[model samples]
Target: MPRRARKYAVRTTYATNAALALVLAGALTACTGSSGSDGGEDGKAGDSSASPTAAEPGKYRTLPKPCDVVSVGTLREMLPGAAAEDDGTAAPSAGASPYEGEPTATYDTDRRVGCRWKNATSLSTRHLNIDFERVVSYDPAVSDDEQAERLYAKKARKAGIPLDPDDTSPDADSEPDPGSEPDSGSKSSGSPKTDSSKKDGEKGSGHKGGTSPDGHTSPSGAPDASSSPEDDVTDSPSATPGEDLAPRSLDDLGDAAYIDDELHTADSGLHRDITLVFRTANVIATVEYEQWVTDKHRIPDSQELQERARELAAQLAEQFED
Candidate 1:
């Protein structure tokens, strides 16, 4: 009899409940070919002791010391009028040198990188409003997808979302109530009696329409519960109040992803690309960075670079906060 193959299976479900409720289902199967007496029906019995090892410590090491700095000063300088460039070009300043001062100083080529800013206005009324910082020992080899998954898992756990590795389907019953408030006067069928204006000499005087003796209408009558100020304090899915007001720090902002094919180049070795997107409220921002890779290096590790990109995104997100 032909040996049977060994199969591993995984099932996934994503339930979306909002204006609409949707349930997505998927399955993944990985099969191993049959093995023989020397190994079993498949290559060998699962080697519990032969678990795959992680990447060697610093196997793809980044520099301990800071590398050269690429001045974003030019980006800052051109930011003011960047919205007016009709040709979609990062037009170079009339008189500027590609190489000047120290590597720590920015090389202002008067050109924009992966993303563009439009209708950018700041409290200072400056043309360009985005700000950035320099980082050293940057590497880009890490998989941003993994990073994003980690972030999702972290957020899900924080929000009390069930995350049982043994169970793929989310606990549907655990979802919070997303319905509107019940009608306030549902239990009160009869209207309260209204009192007419009292005589001037009366000690207890009141007016119609539920006006109090002090002549102030009750809040419940003036502002219906549905239109109450509390209704306006609803939690917005897009706002991050703490993050917006907190002082900036160097902690990991999170993971981000970008496709290499999306990169554009102005000069032979100078390339720029937008790598990540951030949204706060209705405002969206795209972050791009410039790179100068050598001919010998086709692709550099970008994990650290992406980490920095996320930080920049967080900073940008802060701008839209109330």
Candidate 2:
């Protein structure tokens, strides 16, 4: 019970109480942080909202140049005597020929591209246009290939070409036969003669048989029996002059392909328009070839136009692979 012993005891008790209070404060601060509160005891954790979503990536990150999609050799093949691209200048006209290749405008050099060529020969005039498109998908749920396929389907449908029109689709092949019509005059005015009719009556009926399917009537009621049957029977209906062009699917070109052909008759001559479209992976290519024949007496050949357009398509498609 001395004064010194009492003073020391009091100081030790105060120091112990202060140390216990500091430990309790430190434990509370850590608990608040681990509790997942917006503002921890330290108040240093700023806004803690969820992060923005990330975008999906496309298959092809780069596209080829549109102007150089086709080679100079192919361009020459498509348009004989056509000038080639020199540096940034177009080739000069040779002997007044119009078949020259020229690059078209491109809004985005990386995404879209186009080229054109034209020529006028003594026999006919030819023109060709090619376009290339690179597709990209911005959706997280869809892929680049899927997006390209969707666009391809839309283009194919817009072309109006029936898919697989050969055998399964009858609408393309089936047509009302112009020759199948029954002769009304023969049936109404003239009576059906018995097996043994008067020779004079038979001869007279044969001469008066009005008209054939082709509007050319013969002595016999039907087409000339001596002519080949194929001459009268057409495998497929031919395109009539001035008829709207219908799209037809083409095989062995690319993943998918089609062609649209239109025939026009003018005072100057007969002309034809042919369009070919093909898709490969993430790129879709289109080629447009138009022809004008100087001689109205001759009709423009469809096979020739189709073949040339297809060749251009194949050439353009090759660039996508690179």
Candidate 3:
């Protein structure tokens, strides 16, 4: 009786031990599988949770003070009649110079700055101004340079200068070289006669004694007493043989550049204003040269003013480069 009972008890114990082993193995396999899945999910996080791209920063971090940028010598040239320490033979020493350019008011110096200067005397009245802009792009995809380019495009459009000089689009005002012809209504084979040009031509130094600046036909047709033979050529450059001075784009100045020459009558007298604009990297520079002549018959030369303005623009661009 005892042997049989013993045998049954041993079999029951063996069965219980086997059941426990199977349960433990199953639990271990589940833990290993869960750990592997967690590792796979963590490996893919780099692809799904990565940071997005952002725009590049502008090249220029800050802008220079506008009034202090130019030298005394440059100011004297730009604003004629400006008092000088000497008779214009040599540049005044820095820090000791009397010419302190007038700075224009600005809300943010980092974004924009400007300067203006003026000279008035018995001979004539003249003005000069310079401005600088630093563009910054907030968009993630756009860069500072791109922002400046877009702004320059807007300015060029407003300036009314044809980007493509040879452009033949009907909307374009400039005519090509070969096809360009003087208007039939013109006085001669020269620039076409617009009422404004015709009147300005009379006032120009072209005649030994320039006509009156009032746009009126002189009653006496007499030469202006103030006129001299030297006044004949108004520093004007012909856009074309038959064309008036039109605002135009310049290729050699900077990333992009343009010049505008205009003559209009003001209350004081005839005034000539020349504007030159250029872009470089994240910066844009503008130069404005203006002259008001008391002598009604003396019209300021457009080419001369334009050249002076252009030279100033180049200097500003170089400053940014430095």
Candidate 4:
């Protein structure tokens, strides 16, 4: 072969080899870069996987059957004079059974349940209502007890009952006595009439109906020595403080308990309402008992109704324990 031709071929071969080497190096760098970037991404994901994201579960998820929560014997004793249909008693017929209360309407039976009963007689009327609630925990950050506390606060507020149970009497400054305001006109009229009558008695005629100096018959006269003031006592209706009608806190009941008593006057008579609410764990139970009597001034025995309500509340709290 000619020398020049051989030299040119050798140069071309060298150039081709150098180009191939450069191409191979570039491909290797790209692979290394891709592998390194993938490794970095994988490392970031692995670090994040250590963090927890799941929430904690609640203790109670369901409530007891409202009607069955209270024993049958309790119902009979608590609701006196209740008719068969209203008391949950079944008829004597083949299918007839003792009274089992009717449940109230609710969006979800599992979360809440209630029952009511009522009966009326010619002399008096009676009614009973009960409710149950199941609490659930949805926050992973909060514990069941904490969630329950919050729920209890909400319920207490809605019921107008304080959490700590306000044992202290209402402040005089904050709440003015409703009966404190005086009637200026009544005072003025009463005093002048009394004074004038005394003056007239001292002056002349001792008769109670004697005319005053203005020639008007005296209506406010001193009573005769033979007559007693008992008639006045019998004729005037007295005003009472009605403290018995206030809601009071109870002790030795579940976590907390309260009783609210109200007196309602109607054409039938005076109705005494007693509402008892108790809490256990995450569940809250309420029982309302009411009765009407012919006596307008009669206040029902609170202890009796409280005992019955407490008995039922205890039974319901036991269900949570189970």
List all candidate RMSDs to the true structure: 31.8, 19.1, 12.3, 18.2
Candidate 3 runs further than 4 Å off: 1-51, 84-98, 164-245
Best by lDDT: 3
lDDT of 1 at 55: 25
Candidate number achieving the greatest TM-score relative to the actual structure: 3
TM-score of each: 0.22, 0.53, 0.61, 0.56
In order of TM-score, best first, we have 3, 4, 2, 1
Candidate 2, superposed: residue stretches over 4 Å from native: 1-31, 37-62, 80-99, 163-246, 265-269, 294-297
Runs in model 4 deviating more than 4 A are 1-53, 82-89, 92-98, 143-145, 165-251, 266-268
**In model 4, what is the error at residue 264, expressed in angstroms?**
3.6
Better of 1 and 3 by TM-score: 3
lDDT of 3 by residue, 1-322 (tens): 6999999999999999999999999999999999989989987876566656777887888888887788777776665544433344344445323256567665567787777765554445556777777777665566777767766665666555667545322321231112122222101111111233423332222222222222433211222223223322243332221134457788877788887666655444555656688888888778777665655565676666776777788888888878
Arrange candidates, best lDDT first.
Answer: 3, 4, 2, 1
TM-score, prediction 1: 0.22
lDDT of each: 0.25, 0.50, 0.59, 0.52
Worst 10 residues of 2 by lDDT: 185-194
- Per-candidate clash tally: 13, 3, 4, 6
